[model samples]
Target: MVLEKVVEILRNYKDEQDLEVTMASTFEELELDSLDTVELVMEIEEAFDTSIEMDGELQTIGDVVTLIEKAIA
Candidate 1:
């Protein structure tokens, strides 16, 4: 799934990287600033061929995974 691929990308990061986002954490909790969020959305769009609205509700990695599943389904 695209969400799994996204998680894979994040998991491949270095220990010093700010990519340890998880389901229980908010984007802010992950230290993902505005730019990081934008980049992440873009990557997801390109990977899945779907556009995600920035409705301020996708606050965690799990939320994104659920959204992607809905889109794919």
Candidate 2:
């Protein structure tokens, strides 16, 4: 459920980039830089109504999903 929403947000963030986004897709592969990642995180937090701590590394969409699950758990 959360992954779907995250993917939706990510796809919007994907902008004009012609890349496929999946749970296994890394931010790097999506061509998202640090600033883009931050913006993405903010959007996710707002969508989920929760704040995510940058206490660990987040590489892929799955990683972000896990973090959000923990936050909203």
Candidate 3:
């Protein structure tokens, strides 16, 4: 469920030049800036009805998935 929503959110920002986003894909690879990351977190929080404190620790898509799982758990 988390992966699906993450992918859906990512698809909105994906460009033709961007690589296909997988669990290993990082924010740098996706060309997401700090502002983009902030917006993404906000969307995730809204979707899950939870708050995620960004401590500059999240890196990969997998990291976000794990965080969401942990948050919702």
Indicate which candidate wins on lDDT: 2
The clash count of every prediction, one per candidate, is 0, 0, 0
Q: For residues 4-46, could you state the per-residue lDDT of candidate 2 as single tens digits?
A: 8888888778764444678898888888888899899999999
Runs of candidate 1 exceeding 4 Å displacement? 11-21
CA lDDT of 58 in candidate 3? 85
Worst 10 residues of 2 by lDDT: 12-21
User: Per-residue lDDT tens digits of candidate 3, residues 1-73?
Assistant: 8997788877765544344778898899888988998898888788888987689998888988898899999
Which regions in candidate 3 have their CA more than 4 angstroms from the true location?
14-19
Tens-digit lDDT string for candidate 1 (1-73):
6555777655543234456555676668767777787777777767788876778777788888777777777
Off by over 4 Å in 2: 16-19
Report model 3's TM-score to 2 decimal places: 0.85
Sorted on lDDT, best first, the list reads 2, 3, 1
| True-structure RMSD for candidate 2 | 1.9
**Between candidates 1 and 2, the lDDT winner:** 2
